[model samples]
Target: MAPNFGRSISFPLTPARSFSKSSRHVRSVSLPGTTSSHPLLANLHAHIAAVRSWIQDTASLQAGLANIHALHAALADLLLLPASVAALRCTTSNTGDRLLDAFLLLADAHQGFQECLLELRQAAAESRTALRRGDAGRLASASSSQRRAEKDLARLAASVSAVSTKCARLNLVAVSGEEAEMAYALVEAAAASAAASAAVFSAAASMSSAVSSCKKTATFIPAFARKSTAPESAEATVERLHALEQCFDECDGACDMVFRSVVQTRVSLLNIMTPTI
Candidate 1:
């Protein structure tokens, strides 16, 4: 059965556009913090705006998972552009190296977050099965697993925040012209995308504890015994478990996308550090 999430998931009406400037129509684009009429930078700003709009519309973890991925993937796409490549090449190797370190931190955190999601999803599914089978011991084990996954997510979120902070501190005072503008854009996107990822991590952690209605009693008593003791109906708890499982599955897919994007961005940064003959 399809998981019923009780409400409609609203997404951006516009078809997801490529972050490549060549794929987008060029116009005289002007944005704050931007100095040049560079087409790639313009596209970057537009993508950032779209992501900001998504965050404003629906910041909930369930609804914003794809947006979180989109923001990071857009950052990677921005780095792949010819203009972005030229800007990176113009900067000192030290600056490029620092940005590369930030991306590595993000990539590590993203990988950990994906593992947490997988564990959470598996625990939620096991919990549902235990509840259905009236197996108190199994339910308790599953609930413990869920809590552990939530804690892992919380820790991973802290790492993501640190990455954002690191990106914000990468000052490029010596860079001028298009390099300066690209530096601004890169740092801005990194901070924003990391913030989005961190917010979702926090949200997902809280959501696991909030919706698992039987968690408090599942450790103590059998599901049948909870008929009078539990605050919510067994049916409802089952539905919530199913929802959590689906949500985690969805987030995991998005997390994988963001992780790959982070890796790609790092590869591009490495390319910048490499000397071309």
Candidate 2:
């Protein structure tokens, strides 16, 4: 039942140990756009690579569900027979099986969401790699898990959009669609940035070119649905890849704004719909 995505390593821009160094003398580190070296950004890039690797191996939601179902049938005896009534044995088994199945769905949802999150995280990393290499078209060509992750965000946006619409129809106060779209655009823009370039907002020159999936998710999820700050390596500045990273930042910012606005609108609507819950 797992997604039939076998060639995980086919994505064009895997992390490179050798960065494109413009200033080959002084050793400095910082986030993608910031002025100074951030200790956090350095670790962040490494973690992103690890997370992406983990995602490549994780099973799909359907595979998990199928496993859950198989477990229910295989464990019927353990589920059923109390030392009491003979006729009640089969009935108890059925009831227990149903209850267990219900609980397993929760497990499935939790695990599935985690898997989806991994996919999304990898997508962010992949996007960063593409942008750093000045490969926007390559970023667009992402597929399998990456495609699913992009679709997931867009779907999240669509759901929130629907919720916002319902809110407007029901008369609620929330962020506007225009604002949401802007946030989404920022996130999408930030996604494909070059690691070698300093942040457009940064005044400093030696910041690292590494960006985090969390930063990406946090920025966008709240605002289209709501932002990077990438890292540098030892004695190397990822500056040669500026053009793409700059564009990446803008897109990332856009996505963030859109996510936040939509979510805000939905939350407002939910409050109106269920005041006590």
Candidate 3:
């Protein structure tokens, strides 16, 4: 869904100028209702205007993105179009796209968001269906499920925390944590993906732009992508990609072992508390 911007945004591609020295030097004959001694009011007004301009610029981009998110959240909440629209309107951002393709990409984000919501809802509904049917066999064994849940929860928490605190804006001279590069790449890719989707829907997406963005995403394809950092600075990105592949392999082996250990620990504790069951 496209977000409606209530007002037109004026991008100030240039710097603000104060009244010229000659204009400032001109003596003001006080208007009948106002004090001539007060120059601060005019300055204050200029400052407010600048602030308002900034906000409008932010709204242009934020409004669209917010609406896109709303569509997904509404899908998860099992709400209709109205709910999604409401959600989108409530969200705000600092700016919109500089290019036509970017705005179209926003449309793509909306579709992806909806897909995410649908997948989440479907998974939850399936779990509920199993519970209602009393089909324990359809689920993981009790101990295994418990352990998996704990491991998953921990991984999720760590992932979220890492995203929130670890990422800083991209800088040519400065770098961040091990996963920071991936996060930056992922964010850019997500934005690009959204843009590409929008272009596909809009019938206006440039094939060249879409292809470039697609390559960025392709670099991160599962099993083939890397997540870990290598010690070398020269060709560090390539090395990191290699490390990430190793991590995925390690993940398959370690994940099972780690979860089993967690289950064993929990079961042992339960056994100590209860008589042999």
Model 1 residue runs over 4 Å out of place are 1-34, 53-63, 80-83, 90-93, 217-232
Best-to-worst lDDT order: 1, 2, 3
Better of 2 and 3 by lDDT: 2
Q: What is the alpha-carbon lDDT for the whole of candidate 3?
A: 0.27
Best-matching candidate per TM-score: 1
The candidate that wins on lDDT is 1
Candidate 1 TM-score, true structure as reference: 0.76
The segments of candidate 2 whose C-alpha lies over 4 angstroms from its true place after superposition are 1-95, 143-147, 150-277
Cα shift from native, residue 136, model 3 (Å): 4.0
Output the TM-score of candidate 2: 0.24
- Candidate 1 global CA lDDT score: 0.65
- Summarize candidate 3's per-residue lDDT along 80-171 as a digit string, tens digits: 22322222222231111111223232333333323322332333333334333444454224223322322322222222222212112223
Q: What is the per-residue lDDT of model 2 for residues 114-165, given as tens digits with 9 covering 90 to 100? A: 3434554454455556555646465555324454543332322222222222
CA lDDT for candidate 2? 0.28
Cα-based RMSD of the predictions, in order? Answer: 10.7, 23.4, 25.9
Which residue ranges in model 3 land beyond 4 Å of their true spot? Answer: 1-98, 137-277
